[model samples]
Target chain A: MITIAVDAMGGDHAPVPEVSGAVQAASTQDVNILLVGKEQVLQAELKKFDGWKKLPIRIVNATEVVTMEDNPAKALRTKRDSSMRVAARLVRDGEAQGWISAGNTGAVMAISKTVLGMIPGVDRPALAQAFPTIKGKPAVLVDVGANVDSSAQMLAQFAVMGEIYSRLVFHTESPSVGILSIGEEDHKGNELTKSAASLMKALPLNFVGNVEGRDLYTGLTDVIVCDGFIGNVALKVSEGLVDVIKHMLKESLESTIASKIGYVLSRQAFKDFRKRMDYSEYGGAPLLGVKGVVIICHGRSNDNAIRNAIRVATESATEHVNDRIEIEIQRWQASSTNDPEV
Target chain B: MITIAVDAMGGDHAPVPEVSGAVQAASTQDVNILLVGKEQVLQAELKKFDGWKKLPIRIVNATEVVTMEDNPAKALRTKRDSSMRVAARLVRDGEAQGWISAGNTGAVMAISKTVLGMIPGVDRPALAQAFPTIKGKPAVLVDVGANVDSSAQMLAQFAVMGEIYSRLVFHTESPSVGILSIGEEDHKGNELTKSAASLMKALPLNFVGNVEGRDLYTGLTDVIVCDGFIGNVALKVSEGLVDVIKHMLKESLESTIASKIGYVLSRQAFKDFRKRMDYSEYGGAPLLGVKGVVIICHGRSNDNAIRNAIRVATESATEHVNDRIEIEIQRWQASSTNDPEV
Candidate 1:
């Protein structure tokens, strides 16, 4: 059985949603889950749920917890027995195929990278997230917040990784990759993106050239690669805008009696729309390029989000995503050195 | 009377919407309008409207037109008599207090910069556009597509200019300025933004430190400054997302018969929502730091957008925004030299 470890002491609600999600995943999916946290706290939380003892759920005691405010590098050094670290260790020790966390992002990234190590040719691991597009398809955006101030070579690597992930996960035969830029033209981006574009063109991949911010939802490309700085801003800005748009729509819908009644009739449609745009449905972002399958969910993730994250983790492990990434990176590196044009 | 020059040959539907908008602005506002383009063609377009001779409108002949695809620097040097350049010349000769263009953005910027020059001590001019927030108030974003690879010092200057513009245009007292970054912490951004933050804190303006992408719509700050590259990407991305959301919402609302009826009932509310989020309502973005008032509109601008652009240009000239920016820059420079803390 494919076993996954959950950092139960992460997230804002901690232990409650984490434990519930783990139980939900265990009961539904064909995966055993190890809940890593303080045993006494987790045991108390687990007792609240029915059939706690029968489900494929086990608790692993972790002495320390990494708070959201803690510095990632420092926390990783000092809090060796933290829930996040312990969960990563489970994966490293072959006890679990993958690990899921909703902890401090930097800490999760640092701990996962340090414990899992890097895939053979990969210098830095990127965090890849899927965004729903208007075409009802999803595009994978890489380097969301993992590596800021990325070089052209790093961005090129991200494009390759993103392309492979899209092909594997989305089932696209030839995933077209685009570099996130200010404009679609070759002369539009900064020095890094410009250089990255040249390198991408030389690779044996379907590089669709530069795509702007609006393309994030337009389904213009299968995979979009950008520095973590740009990707994070784009993602966060979109999130914020989505919230504002929803709030405005709610206000408009309920402003009048007629519209409120209309809203009632269209409530199902609205639910469908919300589900389409909802990030939780997609679960957590994969910490791509890591040696092991490490999924990082939102810090404010609820039970549903956590459950979905585990599903992603299981699928990633089943697909052997890391192995494919290593193979592709080696292939690309070999081609760049062999091709005279490159 | 304050006179504003309109590039009649600019924009996608040039001389049509441009002519109509000029007529509209002439009919409503207390400003003389100079429609600069090929006089015969503009005259024919103007003849379609009633009472064109009675309105405070006049035509200025220009022989050449700058196509959207033309190289900006090359066009500025070669197309001496282009409509955009002529309008800028009109502003330079004091025939017009301000100029507005929806043509090639680079060409417009180059011509305006060359003709009007820069304010003393201002190294670069930023394009500032107002994004309507959920709070009903708008936040101004500077360097939307100008100065793509900006230095730390340029970003600091943008903050000062943004602050003054917010105070002058938005009628805010001591407007809060924030540097746009991936994270809000002091150590969160890349090298450019990190250094920019330090410089911004030294200025006398109400620097709110660093703001994330979500803060753009949250009304967390009145003015947000960033390098042109990031600003352009953010703005365009928001525009793209807005389009996608509208498309998705429409699809959802029209998916079923009951939802279609609900949409009919909520049509008025939807109309109001669109107007609130409409870019035309905000008019054009000011090319800040130029010696004369220069407003740049969207290439796809309609008659309504053109009319509003003229309104913004007139207001900018009336408020003497350039004068204030010059004075503020000089003051900041003097203060930095005297105070060791700065």
Candidate 2:
């Protein structure tokens, strides 16, 4: 059975949700789970479940905990025995096929990259998240917050990784990749996007031309790639705007009795809308380009989010996504070196 | 009476909406209007409106028009007698206090900047748009598409311009200004935002620290400043996402007969929601840092949007916003020079 390590002391509501989610995943999915945290705390939390003794779940103890306020670099260097660090170590030692955490994102990235190391020929790991599109499908956005400042080559690498992930996860035969920019014209956009577009065109994948910000929700392309800074800003801004629209709609609907009745009738539609927009439905973003699978969830993730993240980690490991990424990167490198003009 | 020039031969449905909007503004507002376009074409369009001759609207003859596809700089140079150019000339020749255009944004900006020139101490002009916030108010986002690659100093200038516009337009006593970044922390951002934050702190304004993308709708700050590239991307992304959400809601609601009845009952509430979200309600974005008041509306703007744009131009010119911006820039410059550390 494929094994996964999870940080049990991470996220806003930890230990309880983490333990419950692990138990749920282990019971439903064909995977063994190693819950990494304080043994006493985790054991107590896990005992509350009815059939906890039957699942393929075990506890791994770690003395330290990394708080959200701790500097990521400093925490990675100092908190050697932290739950997040121990989970990463388990992946490195081959005891677990992948690791999942909803803790401090920066600390998780630093520790996971440092412990499991980078896949050969990959410059840096990128965070890829799925956003629902108008086509009733989800699109993958890469480098959401992993690399703030990225080169054209790095963006090209993101395109490759995003394409592979979209195909494997979404089951698309040939995913169309687009470089995010302010305008659709080839000549438009800042220096980075323009250069990235040229490099992406040289790849073996199906590369659509430059796409504007509007294309994100239009589902004009299956995979959208950009630097971490812009991707992070776009993702957060979309989240905030959605909240604002919902608030305004609620306020407007409550202004009159007729509208209130209308809201009750359309309540089912709103429920469906919320479910589709919910972040937990997509689980967590996978940190691609690492040697081993590492899924990072939002810090405010709940029990459902944790369970879904575990599900994502298991799927990624079972699919052998990392092996495919290595093969793609090697092919891209070989092509680039063979053609001097590229 | 204040006078505003209109580009009558611009936008998707030119001369009809343009002429009708001018007549509507002239009759309702206390302003004289100069409609610039081909004399015969505008006269034919104006003839359809009753009491058009009684309004304080005058027609000026122009031989050419600037299409949306034309290169901005080239059009500015070659289309000397175009309607957009003639409107800018009216402002320069002291015939009108300001100009409004629902034409090509880049062409309008180029012509306005070249003809009217920059206010003293201002490096570049910025485009400012008001976005509805959750607080039932609006926040101004500056440099929406003016400068793609802005320096730290230019971003500081945008903050000053945005602050003044927020105080005058939104009527806030002391508008809180924020530099848009990926994170709320001072140390978390790309090179540009980091450097811009340090410079903004030196200015004598109510400067809030760095804000995240989520802060845009939270109404955490009255004015959000960033390079045009990022701001443009953020603005378009918001607009596109809103459309997608609305489309999804409509699709979801129409799936059932009960929901269809609910939609009819809540139709008024949806109308109210759309009115609140409509860009036309905010009139047009002002091209701040320019010597003359120049407002740019969307190319697809209707008569209501055009009319509101004329209203905005009148208010800006009457309030002498250009003078206030000059004064604020001088004050900031004086403070910066006096403080050696800054």
Off by over 4 Å in 1: A338-342, B339-342
Tally clashes: model 1: 0
Q: Interface RMSD in Å per candidate, to 1 decimal?
A: 1.0, 0.8
Which numbered prediction scores highest in DockQ against the true structure? 2
> Which residue pairs come into collision in candidate 1?
none
- Ten-residue stretch with the least lDDT total in model 2 chain B: B333-342
lDDT of 1 by residue, A203-278 (tens): 8889999999878888879899999988888888889998999888888888898888889889888998898888
Tell me how far the alpha carbon of residue B163 in candidate 2 is from the true structure, in angstroms, after superposition: 0.7
Top-scoring candidate (lDDT): 1
RMSD (Cα, Å) of candidate 2?
1.5
**CA RMSD for every model?**
1.4, 1.5
lDDT of 2 by residue, A1-342 (tens): 899999998777787778888988898889999999999999889889988888999999998888888899999999999999999999999999999998999999999889999988899899999888898788899989999879999999999998888898777789999988877779888888889999998889899878788789998799999889889888999999998889999999989999999999999988888877787778799999999999998888877888888888988898888999999999889978898786
Chain A TM per prediction: 0.97, 0.97
Worst 10 residues of 1 chain B by lDDT: B268-277
Per-residue lDDT tens digits for candidate 1, residues B75-104, read 999999999999999999999999999999
